[model samples]
Target: MTKLRLRQLVIAAPGPEVADDLRKVFQLGKPFHDKAVAEFGLKNSVFSIGDQFIEVVWPVKDDAPLHRFLERNGGAGGYMVIFETDDIDAARTRLDGAGIRRVWNIDLDDIAASHIHPADVGAAIISIDETRPWGSWRWGGPKWKDEAVEGELSGAILESPDPNGLASRWAAALGIPATTHPDVTRIALDDDQTLIFQKGEKTMLEGFCVSLQSAMKALERADDLGLKSQGDTVWVGGVRFVLNND
Candidate 1:
């Protein structure tokens, strides 16, 4: 069975200003482009963070799927991680056989994409997009144009009620080897990316707090610009970070 690789990370926010917050606090550069996926009533910006992207999606319509997500998950956090696959249909077939349901399907001329909800996957939602488009297409809108630069994703920090169980499931689903750490389980991907799942006492979907390489520098810069720190965690503009205890 072909495995799905992590592609993009999603950050859900209540408004467009969150983009600015992410840029200033994380020194994340500029917005890549805007995607107006009409089918989903989604108008969003894609920001480049090395080879991966941080997608900020805001609902164009009150009835859009994003609106419902915000209502359920509350403000900002990692919403999903897209995966790359050679054949989406075949992947979908495999997921369906395992009783997973597709949440959305995006058709872009010759390419197609789909997402599996996190509730079914046991962690973050995963999307599958074809690689052919990356060879030709530019992401995002003109107003906030930027390009992806190469860098290691480092790893993902996820909190779940059953981290070991989730790690086992992902090991089978992603066809990767998983190792048990003192507090979290780590799954290393083919592209030098890692996924870490930490067991939390709660099942509710709380927002994630990312830690970048220059986080301390970013925090210092943010402080000079009037950003406040909550203990060691900083709240700059609107971008927030919490130290990963695990």
Candidate 2:
């Protein structure tokens, strides 16, 4: 099986103000680009979190599904989970055999991506991308490699009533093994990232973890920005941001 490494976490902001709120909450730098993705009717800001990206997207049109997604999740939520794949075609074949549907196909000059429907995976939307010549990401802008700070994308947590079942489903879909336990289920990925499943009332994308230079410093920065934080976790744009020194 080919490797699927977590590359980016996408958040759907209810509006531009919420997006700006998150930027300040995380003390993130300027966005990668200001352009719009016409296919999704979205305008976005991309923040570099180590080699991984944290993207906040705001729908441009009233009819955009993103708006309904926000309504469903109560204003804002984790929208998508993107993975960098070693072989996209093989991944597509695997999904096809399992009767999984690809909601969108994004073919670009430097990349090819396929989006799997959330219904199929029982959680957030999943994207598998193949970059040209292997590890390059054009979506992160040309300056990402040079400008991105050093940190590690630790993993993401999915909340569900049946953690074990959802974890196994996601693991099998991504061709990974699920490690089940009494309290949680974990699927370890490349680059030390792990997909975690925790008990919840509804199955959904819950939160993710990122390692920073200093957790205390990050927390102080958040406080200085007037952002409310509990312990090492902060809520911005309705998603939990966990800061860690690792």
Give residue 36's error in model 2 in angstroms. 4.7
Off by over 4 Å in 2: 34-36
The numbered model that scores best in lDDT is 2
Which candidate number maximizes TM-score? 2
Per-residue C-alpha lDDT of model 2 across residues 1-246, encoded as one tens digit per residue: 676799999888877776687666655667786474756788887778777898888888878889888888987888889999978889889888988888888788788999898888886999999888677887788787766766767888899988888887787678888988777889999878889899999788888787877667767767887777889897777677787885
User: Any idea what lDDT model 2 has?
Assistant: 0.81
TM-score of 1: 0.76
Clashing pairs in 2: none
After TM-score superposition, what is the CA distance of residue 189 in candidate 2 from its true location, in Å? 0.2
In candidate 2, what residue range of length 10 has the lowest lDDT sum? 27-36
